[model samples]
Target: MNAALKQIDAWQTSLAPTLPTLPGNDIDWLAQRRSEALTQFSDIGFPTRKTEAWKYVATHAIAKTTPALSQSTIVDSTQIAQWRLDDCDEIVFVDGLYHEGLSHFTANANIDIKSLAESFEHSPDKIKALLSQDISDANDAFDALNQALLRDGAIVTIADGAVVERPLHLLFVSTNTDNSVTPINNWIFAGKNSQCNIVETYIGADTTNNLTLSRTTINVADNAELTHYRSQRESKQAFHLAELTVKQNRDSRYNAYPIALGSAIARVNVEIILAGKNANCTVNGLYLTKDKQVSDHHIKMYHAVPHCTSDQLFKGVMDDSSRAVFNGLILVDKDAQKTQADLSNRNLLVSKFADINTKPELEIYADDVKCSHGATIGQLNEQSIFYLQSRGVARDQAEHLLTYAFINDVINRIQLDALRKQIAALIIGRLPDSEFIRELV
Candidate 1:
């Protein structure tokens, strides 16, 4: 068989059954999407140095070879104890398979939170209505592949008039057994007048050539509000690719905060589609890297209707020989009049060899819309640093404090106080233990 056909065979063979919990959809549906997805995957399989989108941070290091798909394993209690949270209902997934014992879902009238596999069998109609309805994969191969081979993940659907008082935490840990591979496609939907918060985190207790490509789509109905917090702190040697696409209805609002601090090669692609009039959306991200790691974040907001608004701000701090990439694009369709969008990207490089690539683009077709974008890449303000040093602050301490303050601006915008403080400490602690800071302290 040809290489492509061989790949198809490998993927099809990976869908073998064990306990038959996944009452999967027809192969015809899967095959139809898979065929379309394969065409996209073939068009852009593991972007190379030649691809403009990946021109700066190449994936050749992680893509030199392909590893076999790993088998899903059970998460023993000893390992489950290690996963901790505060005042939150936790849903744990071990290697893309939901763990019932480790999960606690309050089946209240407020919301419907269940495993995708379970929903496939129980709520097939709802599943058929919303699955892959908001996420786009025609331009992305990893997303396309995820749609083609999705097996396990969670689906959070918030019903009207229900406000989840407590935050929903979705935790996925990679129990990479035997060095095989796996990825999960997920979705979350919030209904009209509903309010909820989501904290999705990815951490690896065990790492191999583990590569996770995940796609999450969220829909905010009329007059609804959702605050999403995502944190990535996986093993430094792993490869991670994540995409979040949000769709907003009239008078609906969506806010997203993504924090990246791990992986050898990581990419985050987020897009917000304003399909309804007078919708609003905000996108924010903070990435801290050191030790020659590479992190990339790409954001796109499309104003498909009139009287919508979008705001985006992304900040980064890179040290050692590590690199960061930020690309923010705002697109306003021709008919989308009176739209307002603002975007900005800023990066702080702390080392001589650190690299950062920032691009802010705006494509405006509506003449009356208000839109602007700006980007800046610079170091610590010398005057501020000198003043702090003059005030008895040690040189290293001054720089650390200044750097912390620079990043705190973005951190404080997170509306959830507990999660904001938690992520802030994570960002501050990311400052490497340099010889200079050590000696000064």
Candidate 2:
């Protein structure tokens, strides 16, 4: 067998002993599902560059390491306080296990928030019904792996006709203690006519090479509104892969913002399905990488019903020998008349060796649909830099300003004031002459 298959077999061997100890192991349905998913993962193994969906990023570093379970590391509130948002309910997970001691969230009648293990143990029937659902026609090896080892995560459910005044934040932290791997599977249900905002952040220490495989399944009921923001900041030696699949009902609105930074290799996949008439969604993203880091984003927006709409905007900045990839697709079904879809990807390279590969596609089977897609890859305009330099700005500062401005288009879409400012500062601090731009941004 090849090296990739051998690596996967090793992982399966290591993972077998721990399956019976998981929360829902005794449930036959759940056990069968886990077994099936594990078999699927074993058959496919780790994705290689030959995989069309993962052509730009590599998995050798992650596959070579024997996967171990994540353990808690020493991290004080002060170290992570900056990542939190004020006036919000928050839950903290350390190494994939819910850390109730460090978490703070008020009890509300209209919402139910609990860890996946706890929820499964309390009500296995409901959890089983919901967890059994997956993306209709998508087969992903990471997602299958996540299912095979899924033990703990978060479940957020909003009551019908309820409006949550405060946003909900889920923080997943990986300590820099060992070469461990964490698989997180989250399920979110928004009731009819309900409204809520959610923020999901994945962060790791700078000293470890951890692997985080996470997948979020969101079900939006009719006329519900959900705004989601996800940010990733991993160590230079770490590998991160995340998948977000959202299903929207009639007259519902879903907006998502994803920011990627700080990892040797990171890939995010987002799939949004408009399953009901008049459902709509917007996706905005930003990624910044330096050194030998690689960041990638893939998006698929499907309009399966009439009168649905979607818009996608993604931007990236690369320096040193870092590389980035963006692939977005907008699909309109045969009966989906009056569908409106748009997609755009823009990238700016700050170093001569930095590279970007972008593709924006449109697949429409309906004649009445309006679909458009485009991608732009280039460096900072010298004329614009000269214009700023002529106005007393130094060359380095001018370059920094333009680069900051290029990424700000996506950053500005963040609705939360504190999160937006913090992300802007983080992005600015990664550029040359960052201090000067920090105060200016």
Candidate 3:
């Protein structure tokens, strides 16, 4: 058999025995869905270079590793203390399993929160309804595999016309270094006219060589507003793959900020559908990579109705032999008139050997729509660095300053003060003379 086939066989042989232990396995409907997903995954396996959406990046490393499903690891609160954000309600997941002892959040009347396992036990009907929804338009092998090995994740629901005063933090940590894979599925629903902020963070121990597959689905009701932030800081020896899907109703608003800073091979796919008129969304993202790491971001904005607007801005900074890819598309339906959409991707190659591949696309069937897309990949201007050096700044420090400035635009868009500061500190720490630059910022 070929390498791809071998990988598929290995995965099926290893995971088949554990199917009975998965959450909701006992539910006939859920079990049937899982079985179908597993069959689909077995048939397609992982995507190869021929797959247009995954053409720019290779998945050979993941196939070769073929990490098994992750098992729960004992993690103490102090072990993840540094990752906790202030003034936020936190939910912690270790190795894809919810850890109630490590998670602390206050109960509020306007919002209801539960783990996927809890929902399976107490709210199986709701879970069945969500899992049975149609996602054929964007479903892939990775998504199927996540469902096949479904585990625990957060489920958030905001009451209609209510406002959540504090941000909700969903933190996932990986401490297993035995070549394991963790699958997480999160659901968030913003009721009509409701407002809330959510943050999803993925982190790992330094020596990990694990893999994480996470999927989050969100729905914003009429006139609702949601601010979502995602941060990926897994171990440099690990692999991370994630997907985010959002659907908006009339006059709903969505603001997204995604930052990628770690993982040996990391890929994130984001899709937003404007299902109702007058929906608006803005996405700003940044990816910083060094050494031999790889990062990829794929985004799609679908304008299905009239009078919707979308704006996307993504930036990347690559150093050493690191590589990054950005693929963004804005699609407007034939009847979606008066749509205004724009996409921009800018990348900086900090080292001669660093590389970046960016593609910004627009497909509009509407005649009266306004749409634009562009991409730029280049190195920092030597003249700008020369000017900084002439101003008494060292060469290395000048480069660090310019690099930091390149990603600060996206960082500045984060509205959460505490989270913004924490992200800033993390970014600065990655550059040379971080202590010196910290004083300037």
Candidate 4:
């Protein structure tokens, strides 16, 4: 405890310099929340493989180094144009800091975007309410740190009953000068009866070893709908960690699709709270790891109100000496009767030395509620392989096609066809320079 406390103190002292230098804005009110978050991070500095949620994942490579911050890299229009999605608005952040000149968005009367540091003066109460609402601060460490030392990030507000037809892209790009850790925080709000879709992408430098810590919280109001996708493609030596928590209101829909393909060590968390009756949620994810990398996904779903429903599916593929982990928990409260929830995890090992671990949990208190959990860990079916090979498919091509089919289920579930294709291409693009991806249908 004392050691953690000291670490918190160090974080407070070390990160003070990075705080946004702007005068009175939302950040002033956010100070207390940040301190509390720092406290939480200190109490849980780095989770080890022994931790129930981290058993199959070891974060030693990430915990051993605290890289110094570098001058953030800026993405110009040419670079931004590379990621243009169909019917989308883009907001770019370089190395956790806002790159105003590099970002472009059409002005909408009802929608607004401002830096956390710059918007402090608009509404102290609203800002304070934003910081600590919807989250239980005791269980998470990195999330707490995000609250404590977070300097700047995007704050998006959608007006009541408004619908954003275009997707909002929150892009975070890293530049390599050294092995510094960059933390990016995102705060989002979907008003009552509003609709929104957002994408958060993390990119790393080509040469320098970079580490990114990202946190995002979304508030879905009554009758609102939110669709979110996060893509992580950090540098080869980079370490990436991110957490997403969604709070749902009555009759609201919150859906998330997270696809991770880069980074040496990656950890992602998804927490969905069904706070209102009749709410619905779906948490879906896909990840692929190669060489000596590691990736993990942890999910928690809570049915606190009656008439709520949740479904979760996570899929992963590991090749070479890489490793992947999936941990999911579903909880149904006693009074939350008529609740329906299910959790499933499917994984594949593409190489003899690759590793995979999966765990799905269910905690139900109501007798009338329905809940179930299942997980599967296996390699490609040999019979299917034999049939394909016999049908004139080469050995490597057959293996690659089967592997693509294994993960294609998750791809097919993505609501956005373009995003699905982008993710598929990313996975195929990294196919070890072999014939594996070329043969996939």
Candidate 5:
């Protein structure tokens, strides 16, 4: 057999012993879903270069390594203290399994939170309907694999007309360096007229070379509002792939901010559907890559009904030999009149060898709609650096300031004060002369 086939065979053989141990296996419907997902994964394996959505990314390395699923590890509280945010209700997952000891959050009457395993036991029918929904028409191997090896994750539900005062934080940490994979799946439901904020953070041990496959599904009911912040700062030796799927009802609103920094290879896919009239969405993202790391973002915004609106802005700063990709599309259906959509992707290549591939598309079948999409890829402006130098700033420090400003444009849009400050510090720490930059800021 060829190398790809061999890798696929290896994964199938390795996962056989653990299939029965998966959570929710005792439920007939859940077990059948898992079996179907596993069958799909076994048949198709991972995506290749021919896959349009993943054309810019190469998966050969991941296939060759074929990391095994990670086991729960004993993590110290001190190791994760730095990643925690203040005044937020936190849920912790270590090495893909829910870690109750490291997680603590105050309960609110309007909010209901439970682990996936707990949800299966208490609300099997609801979990079944959510998990059974299709993510996409085309077969996605990663999605299949995530469901097939399903473990523990978070399930959050907000009551109608409720307003949450504190943000909800879901933290996932990886401490294993034995070339393992961690799969996580989460669900969030916001009832009518509710408002809340959620933050999802992923971190790994610095020296570990693990893999993480994560998926989060969200539903916003009529007149509800949700702000979602996703921060990915894994180990530089690790691989991270994540997906965010959202459905918005009439008059619902969703705001998203995604920041990517640490990982050898990281990819995030976002899909949003405006299912009812007057739904709105805003997605702003930033990705900073250094060394030989690769970062990618794919977004799909669908306007299914009339009077819906969406706006997308994504920026990337590539240093050293790092690479990045941005693929965004806005689709307006035929009957979706009065739709307003816009998408823009801007990239900065700080190194001569650093590169970016960006594609922004607009497909509007409604002639009365207003939609636009565009992309820009360029380097730091020399004149701007010279202008800063003329003001008594050193050339290197001036460049650093400009780079920080480029990324901060999106970071500043975050409404949560504590989370914004934490994200800024993390971004500043990744720059050259971080301490000096921090002092200047």
Candidate 6:
């Protein structure tokens, strides 16, 4: 067997003893689903460099370590406060398990929030319908693994015609003292004509080496709108893999912003389906990696119906020996006439050792559709840096300003004011001339 297959074998052996005790495993259907997922994962194993989609980054380091389940530990209030979004309803999960103590929410007639475990126990039928729906999960190893080991997460449902003004925050925190892995599954169901905003944040304590595998499913009914934002700031020793699957109905709108700031290896796979006519989807993402970290993003936007629109913009800033990968695909079916799609991936490298690989692809079967895709990888403009330096700015500060300006476009797209500022601060702090940037901003 290959190394990837061996790793899968080891993981299966180590995970077998804990399977019976896993939450929701007692349910026959859920158990059978988990088994099927495990078998699928075993067949594919981890995606290695040989895999076309995963060619740029290696997964050997992650495969070498076997992951155990994470346990709850004491988390400081300061750490929690740092991640809290102002004026938002919060659902806190520590080590992939929902924590009642740290979570805060109220009973709203128009909105309902419940833990995934509770939903599975109380409304198995509803949960099953949502769980059974898949958007390319079987084709991905990490997503299948997440399905097999999924434990707890938050599920939010917005009532029809109701508008939620405040954003709902789902915070996933890892405080693992040892090498472990946590798999979380979240669902969002937006009813017809309803509107809501969701913010999912992934963070970890210092020097955490845990692995987090997350899967999110979103369903938007006709005329509904969903603004989704996800940010990941984990320790450099940690690994993160997340898959987002979304299906939008007729006349619905969905906007997504994914930001990656920290992690040794971070990958996010986003799949969106415009399943109904006049549906619109937009995705804007930014990833900043320093040291030896690797950040990868793969996005697939499908215009499944006529008169649908989709747009995507992804940018990355890499320093030190870090590497980043961006692969985006826009597919328009033969019958999807009048479809409009655009995709752009741009990267900036700060060091000679840093690297980036980006590919933007479009597959259109309808000649009436308008689809455009492009990819760019380059350094800062020398003329722009010279102009800043000539204006009395220090050389280091000039370079920092140019780099910050490159990513500021994506930052400005964040709808939440507090989140936008917090993300800006985090990005500024990572630069070499943070003090100067802070003083200027």
Q: What C-alpha lDDT do the candidate models reach, one value each?
A: 0.77, 0.86, 0.90, 0.77, 0.88, 0.88
Candidate 4: Cα lDDT at 252: 96
User: Cα lDDT for residue 250, model 2?
Assistant: 99
Please provide TM-scores, in order, for all candidate models, with all chains considered together.
0.89, 0.96, 0.98, 0.90, 0.97, 0.97
Worst 10 residues of 4 by lDDT: 19-28
Deviation in angstroms for 337 in model 4? 0.6
Question: Can you rank all candidates by lDDT, best first?
Answer: 3, 6, 5, 2, 4, 1
- Ten contiguous residues with the weakest lDDT in model 6: 129-138
Clashes of each: 3, 0, 0, 7, 0, 0
Best by TM-score: 3
lDDT of 5 by residue, 269-377 (tens): 8889999899999998899999999999989899999999998899999999999988898988999999999998999999999989998988889889988888999
Give residue 121's error in model 1 in angstroms: 3.6
Q: Which candidate is the best by lDDT?
A: 3
Q: What is the total number of backbone clashes in candidate 6?
A: 0
What's the TM for model 1?
0.89
Question: What ranges in model 5 sit over 4 Å off?
Answer: none
Tell me the spans in candidate 2 whose CA falls farther than 4 Å from its real position.
136-138
What would the per-residue lDDT of candidate 4 be over residues 98-203, giving only the tens digit for each residue?
8888777987955677776555566666666776464744465666656555666788888889898878888888775577767776788889999988888887
Residue 366, model 5, lDDT:
89
lDDT of 6: 0.88
lDDT of 6 by residue, 257-368 (tens): 9998878999998889999999999889999989999999989898989999998899999999999998899989998999999998989999999999888889999889
Pairwise TM-score winner, candidates 1 and 3: 3
**If candidate 6 were superposed on the true structure by all CA atoms, what would the RMSD be?**
1.4
RMSD each, Å: 3.6, 1.5, 1.1, 3.0, 1.3, 1.4
